[model samples]
Target: REHEPLITVEVAVQLTDAKKFFKVPRTFRVMVCPGATVATFREVVGQDLAPSGRVMVPRGKEAMMALQDSEELPDKVTVTEFKGKRQVYVKFTMAQCYKVLSLLRGHLEKAESQKALHEAAIEVAEDEMEYRLRLSQFLMTEAYPVVCRHFGLGCDGVESLRVIPAGMYLVDQHLELLELQLEVETLMKNRGTVNFLMGKINELRHKFGLPPADYPPHLLNFVYSQSLLS
Candidate 1:
């Protein structure tokens, strides 16, 4: 068995194979399961190490008949220990290579199916800020003019309104009115006129010993208005 030369066999494969070639030849490597020597392995039927260049693999589907085949199927194995004392190696025939690859193919398909199902089941929610930003984008991009169209103003200056006091302006004349209205509103609020009034009352009551009901802001007449009226 040791002196026997490995017989080279010619392999003939047809090329009508189109998409099948796209599926690259996948290798399913595994360490030879130790403690199962070729002798003990040969005991099983239909399992003869093939006469490939090296390495013997099963040629049997049956436990009894395969061992008989191995007696004639000289050993083609060349054992190599990987790295240090990690593992012993034994090669297999092309037929055995197919067996391992078949198992891998099945497992890979199942894994892909599971991954797809997991992805489908997931329901990622939109964040609050993301939704608000989308609403802002739609308003800035589309809503303003559409609303103006509803009013029949023939307005088309939505993008310009990125600043405040933005809507429904015919020209620069409206800007001063809008500014005054904003100032009036602000002065009327708690942070404006109300606050100023309260502060003044406090100053009068504490510094002058005058009550709030008796004190109001002292009026200062501007020269322009007074002179004009005169």
Candidate 2:
């Protein structure tokens, strides 16, 4: 209720999603209460403004009031472009109309979801394969040396990375990285933690024992040469 909302403003609405492509209303009106503030107008219908393809379910004070008892009235409706073309019964209240609007928030837009989902799916696959290879190599070449140096449990014939408890050891190594990436992605999605993103980079560098990213070029080159030659 906005504008001339005395007791309550009667309204009609349609909101739903199970249709082809994005939906939009065939036609709609711009009527608003004469003295309704911009805030009031927003309160009433600001959210229904999605373009073609997104659900444009009908919404209006008159429509909601008019179709209060129509048998053909939809419990929910999807919109198509050109609200004039989309046939929807009037909604009953801004609240009822907006309830269906809630469904729109998580609706995956095709391009974004596909790209993100594909990236995630492929990333997990590639990371898993790489982790398996590196971990297998680590057990044979590195862990035994480390274990021998530290615990002395590494004895004869312990040639490879000890296969500890099947997949458990491998999971421990890569899962931490995966968890960090997931946390970063979640924060980014909600437009949060620019500071944390920077902090994370610093933390990861230290955690991985990495040299400063901006280390002098000659020093880096010498280090690289030493690594290769030595």
Candidate 3:
């Protein structure tokens, strides 16, 4: 009869007294037969470590939790129980795991910082767009009609009287609106950059072995949902 193939699994070992021992947590890959007992797996992991007391594996979902709150794997449990899992967490004691966590935390921090900057830029862009829209509306709806009445041209002559001094103000306002529109277009194009940064933040979070972030409604929704000009 053919024998079952060996399964390769990653074992992440948490050092008990990392600070005192001046050592960091470590991970090792080991090959074990499908039906191998948990006891056998622990022995194999111990061979690569120092004389750090007992080697214990966390049970099921507890592997992702703090070591102190996690239950140890039973000696009679078969390695095949974890066949689908790529990595397992083990430790010498219930103490905290450092080193690897610290490195991942550093990466997460940087990603969060970059995301913040992108969010700030989006807010500024939205504010500037709103300001320009308000000014343009005021000039067209309120100021333009009042100027036409003062020049005794009424609404009909307003467009034909562009050469007059009063009409020049309307012309200048139109040019300003065009410039503002261009600036808004440039800012809207930056939405792609903001999306790229958000992707990086989520990627880093996953690498840190964290759950999805709970963003506020405004952030969770699309940054530019409505037309800026509208």
What TM-score does candidate 1 get on C-alpha atoms?
A: 0.17
Query: Which residue pairs clash in candidate 3?
Result: none
Total backbone clashes of model 1?
Answer: 14
Candidate 2, residues 55-144, lDDT tens digits: the string is 323567544222221223232333322223211112113332222122222222335543543454345453534434443443355333
Model 1 lDDT tens row, 1-230: 11111131111122224675666332212222233343433222112223321233335562222223223332333211112111112233233333322332343245553343233223213233443344344334444344333323233444313321222122122323323333332221112333354444455455656554332322212111221111
Off by over 4 Å in 2: 1-127, 154-160, 163-230
Which candidate has the top score in lDDT?
A: 3
Score every model by TM-score.
0.17, 0.16, 0.22
Please give, for residues 51-136, the per-residue lDDT of candidate 3 as tens digits.
33334555686553222212333332222112222222222110111221222234324555335434544555656555444434
What global local distance difference test value does model 1 have? 0.30
Order candidates by lDDT, high to low: 3, 2, 1
Best by TM-score: 3
Poorest stretch of ten by lDDT in candidate 2: 163-172
